[model samples]
Every structure is written in structure tokens, then in C-alpha cells.
Target: MRNEKKKSFYQEFEVFSKRTATSPFQHQFCLLAPNEEVAMVMAQENFMRREPVADIWVVNRKHIRTLHPEEKRMLARIDNKDYRTTKGYGYLRKKWRQYEQKMLDEKEILSWGGDKK
Candidate 1:
């Protein structure tokens, strides 16, 4: 087997999917295949067999640009803007409790535009 030749056409891919219409797209796993077509076919039978996947995305790893170790060290560290975070806002929840009302959390605010049940 030492003299055997391998096909370079098979590429690494990142697979992401969502289980339902309202569910966010999540990273399921990775796979190696010749192309997107084969990857989709394989993913359907091999990966999504037990889960209800509403969508499928197959992206080649080479096409994705990622930060290098040196780049990470060069980047500046920064604190998150307080307005963009949910922490340090527990006081709002306590205030709502005084009125016997539930607090509108991040999830509740984001679901304002979602279809009603």
C-alpha cells in the first residue's frame, strides 16, 4: 500500500445545518468528499438520517479564511460594550418582579418579529 496513489480531488468540507424553520443554523460536523454534490448526498444519508435538517450548507475548508497564531497575538483585546450584553442587567428583572410581571429578556426581544404560535 506504500506505493498506492491518493486522489487530491477529495477536499475537506464544513457542514452546517438547521433543524427547523425557526432554528438557527448550527455547525453539525465535517466530511471529506470529491465535491459539493457528493457531499450533499452523503450528508443526507449519513448525517441527517436521524435529525430533521431544514437546510444544508457545504463549504470547502480551503475557501474559508481564518486567523493565524501571529495575527491573533497582534489583535487588540477589548471589552464588550455594555449595551450589547445581557449581563449587569439583572436589576431590571428584579424590578419587574416587584410589579409581578416578567422581564423582557434578550430572547423575548429578538422574537418580536417571529411568527406567532
Candidate 2:
């Protein structure tokens, strides 16, 4: 062993991957390396050794910007906005029953536009 001082080469990195083009990116795992390029290479062998990988991303933990709790509170949304969801339209179901008509929700309506095959 050489009697020399060693630098802190390993840094924290977060990894994300996706299996297909239409799939959303999901968190895989983290790795430690000297830089992002090396981290990516290391992640391929460690995380995706068996499965297929469409995309890969390695983000340095230090470079990631995050908001504080107060900032997150500022972005909080209330559930009172019934008009944004199906809750506001729920009354129509009872009205349809009164008229002896079937009520169609989002899924039923969307099924009409599905592939013909």
C-alpha cells in the first residue's frame, strides 16, 4: 500500500430508468461514483443486469434542487374542487335512475373511443 492521502472520489447519485418508450420513468436505485458518467455505467450493470432498459438517468444528489416544507405547503391543493373530478357529476346518476336511463361514467364513455380491434 502506498503511503499517500486519498481523495473523496465516491459521490452520491440517484438513478432512474424506464423499460419502454410509453412507460413513465421510475426510481431504480442509487450508486456512488466519481461522476455522473461513471455512475450511469455502474448503474447499468447493478440495476438492469437482467431486465431490459430503455432509458437511464443518473443525477448527482448534491446537484438536485428541492423545495423546503414551507414551499411544499404553498403548493398544497384542497380536495374541495369537486368540479375537477367525477364527484361533482355524481348527482347525475340518481337523476338518470329517476328517468330510467343508464348513467355512463368516464370509463364507459372512454371505452367508446377504444380500438376497434
Candidate 3:
């Protein structure tokens, strides 16, 4: 059928881009093309047409290594680590308030940026 032929005309191509000189390559999305030349030619207009793309790469889908469903399940984390976060020190807000001093929350601490004057 015509649909089958058109399907074969466009193989899956993974697109990637670099936003800036020091930025790392990132996966954008996938498209379909018949060959590497077609994939490369189509990569820009198909994915980065309206974005700032410093670079691009079009790879065949079969060349990618992806996590399996079971492997993906291993990425889960437990919810018992509140002690490792600011939420654990939430009482500091009330304590600081009692002292008539503002709580040095995350936004304030990050703004310090090595100069605490």
C-alpha cells in the first residue's frame, strides 16, 4: 500500500541540539527520514526551526540505547529523606521569628553567592 511505502521512506531519526558554546548536547526529539542525508537535511527545519540551535545531530533510532521498563523502575527514591532537606529545619522559621530575625531561607542563602556582606 502507499502508506507502507511512505512509512519506509521515513525512518526514525533522533534529533539533538546545543544551546550555547559551553552547553552540553541534549536530545530534542525524533523524526522520520529515509536516509542519513535526508535525516540531516530535515533535522533543522523539523526540530530547531524556531529555536536557537548551535548544533544538531540526526541519529537513527536503532542506534540509541534506552532503559527498559524494569531498569526504569530502579530510578525510584524513598520519601524518608526529609532530614536531608530544608523541610526538616522548618522549625527554624518560628525560632528565628521569636528572635525578631528573618529566616535565612533558600532564596536568601543562594543570593549570598560567596559574599555575605
Candidate 4:
């Protein structure tokens, strides 16, 4: 049948685009195309015509990997990274003050490479 023939030739593709070079790519929509080239052309014509696009990505749906609910739960658990943050080391400030010395925090350390007068 005509429907069966078209289904065999077309593949589902997901389109993603970004407004600026530094901006992250966001999902625009999905469409069926015969190949990546056709998908890209179709995506630009359908989605990018109305807005500015810095980049375009056309990925076949089958090639995209996704995490299931169980896998997502594993990644969502608290990661015990508090020690890398200032709040976890708040007591250090008081300790340094007791010694009559200033504590070099993250911001101060990052400014070491900046211009100095």
C-alpha cells in the first residue's frame, strides 16, 4: 500500500536549535524524513524560518539515548558534594578570624588571574 511504502522510506528525526553560539540547544520539534540531509532542510524550513538560529542539529530518534525512571532516580540522589561549596566550609571563616588572618574563598582565588593595579 502507499502508506507502507512511505513508512519504509521515512525515519523520525528530532530537531534542536540554538539562538546564539553560547546558548544551549533546545528541542524544537520532530518530523519524518528520508535521511539526515532531508531532515535538516525540512527542519530549517519549518522551524528556523520564523526565528534566528545559530546552530541546528537533526538526530534520528532511534539514535538518541534516554534514561529510564530507575536510572533517573539513581542520578537524582544527593551527591554529597557539599564540601565543595562555601556553606559547608562556613566554620573555616570563624577559625581564620580567630587567627587574625583572612580566609581565601573561591571568589578571591578566582580573581588571582585578573588585572592588578
- Winner on TM-score between 2 and 3 is 2
Candidate 1 local lDDT, 1-117, one digit each (tens):
432333476788899899888889888889989888998888888778887888988888899999999998878658666766688686787787765544446557778879877
Q: Compare the candidates by TM-score and give the number of the best one.
A: 2
Candidate 4 deviant stretches above 4 angstroms: 76-117
Which digits, one per residue and each the tens of the lDDT, describe model 2 over residues 1-117?
232322366788999999998899998887778888899889988878879989988989898899999899988786578788888899988887866544445557878898977
On TM-score, who's better, 1 or 2? 2
| Comparison by TM-score, 2 against 4, better one | 2
Candidate 4 steric clashes: 0
lDDT of 4 by residue, 7-98 (tens): 98999999999999999999989999999999999999998889999999999999999999989888864868888888999998788786
How well does model 1 score by local distance difference test?
0.80
**Root mean square deviation (Cα) for candidate 2:** 11.9
Instruction: Assess the local accuracy of residue 75 in candidate 2 as a C-alpha lDDT between 0 and 100.
Output: 83
Go through the candidates in order and give the C-alpha RMSD of each one to the true structure.
14.3, 11.9, 10.9, 11.2
Error of 1 at 29 (Å): 1.4
Which residue pairs show backbone clashes in model 2? none
TM-score of each model, in listed order: 0.58, 0.67, 0.60, 0.59
Write down the worst ten-residue block by lDDT for model 3.
Answer: 98-107
Q: Give Cα-based local distance difference scores for all models.
A: 0.80, 0.82, 0.83, 0.90
Query: RMSD of model 4, in Å?
Result: 11.2
lDDT of 4: 0.90
